[model samples]
Target chain A: MSELAQALDTLARRRLGGDAATGLARMTAGATQEIWRFMLVKDGAETPLILRRAPGGDRVSESATGLEIEASLMEAAEAAGVPVPHVKWVLTPDDGIGHGFVMAFVEGETLGGRIARGEAFAEARKVLTRQCGEALAAIHRIDPAAFPTLKRVTPLEFVTQYRDGYLASNWPRPVFDLAFRWLLDRCPPPPENPRLVHGDFRNGNIMVGPDGLRAVLDWELAHVADPMEDMGWICANSWRFGVEDKPVGGFGLREELWAGYEAAGGEKVDPERALFWEVFGSLRWGVMCCGMANSFRTADPSVERAVIARRTSETEIDLLRLLAA
Target chain B: MQDQPTPSEILGAVARFLKEVVVAETKGATSFNVRVAANALEMMRRQLDTAPAAEAAELASLKALLGIENEDEGGDLATLNAELARRLGAGELDLKTPGVADHLWATTLAKLSVDQPTYWGYRAALAERAAPTET
Candidate 1:
């Protein structure tokens, strides 16, 4: 048996006593980690559970957020009325499984392209923008003081981080240079009330059901930052997935999203802040593309990463559109 | 001179084969790989068709904007661009600088023409440029 399977079985026994884990199998090789789906047979009942963990070993190294913190954040968000999968157990060194947490498996469409273009989601798309805005507001309402360990970043600091990353990538495109300068010049003042920012809140990170929004996944990049950062990221052109007309995650308009957010008790959405963050998001994505290519050169030589590098030009054009006026 | 089938044509042929044949036969991750491979092939084809002239024009603009003469020995596109990026980062060149915005716009538009002509932003910019003047 694989080390993960043995660990899950042992952990399952400890948690469920008589009802042991019957089967554990690999699910998907996600971008950052490995996902495993297992079944626990307790009292003639079969319950499905999902385990998300860092792939290599017991020590979590590569991820920005540790599994323990992610579990805690999920619990906090769930308590704050955000839809997130119920975390079942957090793996410890004693559990023999690598650092991870098991949660109830959520069944929905997570693919952004499919959610954007698929006809089956047409009904759900009608209300998803508002739902997404409401959910983001709830997420922002989570007190940063509650999570003492979450990184607190100012707007200027965030831009500086992107600037440093772009410089470190060593792939100097003039367009990126122009964007860095422009973002630096247009940096907004730090917010007085910084809230929890869902750092990667966008179409793909969300799970959509036929009815409407189900849950927000991928809390790896969550931090304490400007609430408007989340608002802008969801509306960034990159997340539109070819539905260029629909500004908010290819689902609806900014007005609808903003209205929902305000209704949900978030501070009035700032259009200028959102726009700045959109531009920032695009430039950050460009730097990320370059960084991915740099990593491909130094580490994993995957074809996907190589292809992603070519997409830097896409962001260049996007930057021009955003900055031209 | 090269053979009748030029490099660009060769790439186009391979891209078509991958998109039409291999992609249809594959599933899951392999299918995704085939698609990305085909896209990269097409991008290479477009670059081969457009890069030389684009790079030349870009180099000329960089030379003019930065006021570099042949005596300095830094007219190549890569070196000139690296220098330009360094200057921009250091605030040596700003939007107020003569020809800086025009150079950036022309160069970026040229790149988009080759890299993603159908991109929404590129198309919108093109339309905005060709729109009828205000009365």
Candidate 2:
């Protein structure tokens, strides 16, 4: 058995009520992290679990968000009525599982393409989009002061930090530099009141079921900042999955999302500010795609990732045109 | 037009061959190595397909936009890339001007295939945004 499997078996015996069965199925998305679905069967009842581990190749930074923090945040969000899977266990460096955490395996449709295509969840898509907005509002409503363990960064500064980080990497993209200048020249001030922000909240990161949203998954990039950050992120064009016409992850309209947010007692969002952040979000993703391209150039060369990265330039151009307008 | 394989073309061919053959063999190895190799191959393929076209197009566009008649002397990719950045940094290209929108549209179409519906959707959106408001 592999080291991860053995460690999981140990963890299963310790935490779960039954024997753990491991099967590796490839999740279509997630460029920065590897996701594996782990199945646990105890007392003839099978429980599905998700294992998220760090990238195996070259280390970009030792300070990458640890899995323990992710698990803790998920648990907090779940407790706060945010739809998220239950955290079962967190594996530490000493656990020999290589920086990962185990959570109850969420059963739902995750692939954004499928969701955008409305193949499996046509009716669920409209409901889930509103639910996504509601869930995002719930996440943003979480008091940052309560979660002192989570990192705090101003929402407006996210754009600068991302731009500077990508620029410092010295990737061969002048468009990114242009986008950075545009972002800096038009940087909106951070929200008056900060709250927990899921840095990577979008349709793809969310899981949906027949009932509605199963869970908002992937908290690796979670942070505390303007709630609008999540709003802008979900509305970013890249997440629309070719259905740019349907702004809310190609499922529903933005007004419907705002309606859900307002119903959830969330603060009214400024359209102009949301537009700025939406542009910023697209630009940030463009730089990230450049980083992925750089990764392909230097360390790992996954065609899937590279192709995805190359397509980011289109997004960059799109944002530039938006800002130029 | 028939021509000899350029350096970028040669690299692309090699990358395509590797993706077709070598990548499949490395699938069962350490995921890290597999990902690295796969990405490298794709990057190489992209460089082969895009690098030359990108270099030539950027130079031509810059020169035409700036009305420069002199031939570009930069031979190496780094030098050309840096020169393009320098030119762009000088504020020679303004994407906000009237005709520049058309240029931006053309450039976008060139980079992202014109055939992509998303590209045209974006163009239409931009056009709608730029249109004069009704009283």
Candidate 3:
């Protein structure tokens, strides 16, 4: 057995009361996280569980909110009616597996393109927009006291941050320059009651079923910010795949998402501020695409990383669509 | 001059091979990556065909926007683009300026033509440009 499998077996033995962790396989889902699928066996009973561990082996950046913290956030989110994988065990120092947690494996489609276009999700498509809104409202409604450690990043702070990122990238793209200028000039004030914003709410990050949304995935980017930012981030064209007309994750409109949010007890939707963040989201994705491209040269020079540089222009065109007269 | 069976022609062959042959042989992650590789090659082939003219057009626009007389002296497209970005960042030029918005729009459209012509945003921009509508 590999060291990871042994540790997982140990972890299963200690916490899950399972004799062994069998059928261990690495799942290639999230690019930056280590996802392992395994079945824990205890007394002839089997339970499928997923292990989400830190990436890059012992290089947890300062921005990482710690796996324990993420596990706890999932617990709190479950309480707030947000669908998430139930975090079962957090690795102790004795496990020697670095930072990670085990959760009950979620079953659903996570592919953005498939969810947007596949006939399998045809039923899910009808209710997904409202469900997403409701889910976001629930996530935002979670008491801040549950996660005091999460950083509070307002629009202005992140806009300036992306601008700095673009500058550091030394990109000569004029659209990015114009986007930074436009966002900085019109940065909205932080919400009166700053809520827990799912910093990376989009199609791929969400798991859906034939019925509707199953669970919202990827809580690593969770932070405190305006609730509408969630709505706007989903509406960003980058998340739309090729279905441009259905802006809300290429499944529904912004108004429908806002309706679901409001119906679920979120604040009245501000179309203008949401539109601003939509623009903000586009530029942010653009800068992040460039970041991936930058890493292609030194850190990881895979063909995948090299070609992602071309996708930066996809975000550029998205920005133009939003900001153009 | 570059010889016949040019760089683009070679890329086209490789892309066809990957899409038709290599892709069928691979499975799982390797298959997905082979597809990505083939698409990248196709994108490169498209860029080779379209990018030079687009770059020339963008250079001409940048010179006009910056009010420069000599292309040889004013620096190449990359440097001129850097200046444009800097000026925009510093508030020296803005959308109100005659050529700023148009230049930005045209340059981005040109880039999409080479980078991702099938991208939804690119198609939308093309459609909107073809017919003005309240979208």
Candidate 4:
């Protein structure tokens, strides 16, 4: 049996008070973590659950948000009225399941390409943008005090962290240096109140359902900082998926999104500050793409990642142009 | 006059041969050699395909943007590559300046040439997302 199946069986007996129905299937998309879908039977009914685990012999980064922390953040966000997947249970490191967590399997479409193509989701696209804005506002409004385990970084410090992290990686590229300088010069004053910020919020990161937004997924990069960082990241041109005309993830207008934010009682967003973060978002992605490519030398020699690294030059260029503008 | 093949041209021919013959034959041959050969082949192919064009374009653009009209002493590919590397390493590119847009456009084009479909798809997605929201 697969390791995941064994873990599921063990967890079912220990926690769910039943037996695992089957291994079901595994979904492999994330380069960093392994995600599996399984079914558990407790009498005659079946409950669907997701299992996330670290890859073979790999350990989670020290700086990364742990599975327990992510679960806590999700719980807090849900309590604050944010639409998110209900946390089932967090598997402790001693569970022999590696570092992972179990959560309710929320079904929805997550393909950014399909949404951007304007076919099945054409009618729902306009509403999805507004939904994203509202969802983000709800997440930002979460009380940091509610989640004591979660670490908070000042907005300026977060910017510095990204800047220092990329440079310290020792990948020599002049464009990144330029982007760093621009980010430093344009650092917005720290937020008056720090709030939960979804570090990787974008079109691809969100799952959209027929009704509207289903659940916000991938909180592995979550943190507490300036909420506008999330707004700027979602609207960055790199996340727009080639539909230059549709700035809000190929979905709706910025004003529409902002309107939704205002309705959710979000503070007035500064356009200039948003632009700065947008540029920084692109720069951060550029660095990540480069790192992904470099990583192919060791773990996961994916052609796709190598391709991604090559494309970072383009993103870097975009950031440079934005900085210049 | 018979034009001799440049170093990049020679490498390109070898890469093409490897992709067409060796890579295709490897499917039936051996698994161990498959991944190693494929990765090495890809790197070689990328270098062969991109290096010359990238170097020439970068030099021409930099010269034009910097307005250095004098004939470049670094005419050969090696010298040009070294100079480009030096300039980039020394942080002379000035990415925050408006003039960097030309460099960015050029670099973007270079990257677009080699990036896989997923990268293009992501770019398309980002552009689509940004369009309706553009003010």
What TM-score does each of the candidates earn? 0.92, 0.78, 0.95, 0.78
Local distance difference test, per candidate? 0.84, 0.69, 0.87, 0.70
Those runs of model 1 whose alpha carbons end farther than 4 Å from true positions after fitting are: A16-18, A59-63, B1-4, B24-27, B69-73, B90-92, B96-98, B113-118, B130-135
Complex DockQ, candidate 1:
0.60
The full ranking of all candidates by lDDT, starting with the best, is 3, 1, 4, 2
- Give me the TM-scores of chain B across the candidates: 0.88, 0.43, 0.92, 0.45
Candidate 2 vs candidate 4: which has greater TM-score?
4
Residue-level lDDT tens digits of model 2 in A191-237: 67888888898878888876678989878787778788788888888
Candidate 4 chain A: minimum summed lDDT over ten consecutive residues — where? A316-325
TM-score of 3: 0.95
Chain A TM-score vs. truth, each candidate: 0.96, 0.87, 0.96, 0.90
Q: Write the per-residue lDDT of candidate 1 for residues A146-165, one digit (tens) a residue.
A: 88888889999999999898
Tens digits of lDDT, candidate 3, B1-135: 979999999999999999999989999889999999998998889889988988899889989999998867789888999999889877789888998889988888878887788888888888988898775
Tell me the docking grade of candidate 2. Answer: incorrect
DockQ, every prediction: 0.60, 0.21, 0.75, 0.22
Residue B58 displacement (Å), model 3: 1.4
Give the per-residue Cα lDDT of candidate 4 at A271.
85
**Residue A301 lDDT, candidate 2, scale 0-100:** 67
TM-score of chain B of 4: 0.45
lDDT of 2 by residue, B38-135 (tens): 55554565555665676577666645544557775444445554454444434454455334445444555455542133454466554665794685
Say which prediction, candidate 1 or candidate 3, comes out ahead on lDDT: 3
Q: Residue A123 in candidate 2 has what lDDT? A: 75
Where does model 3 exceed 4 Å of error?
none
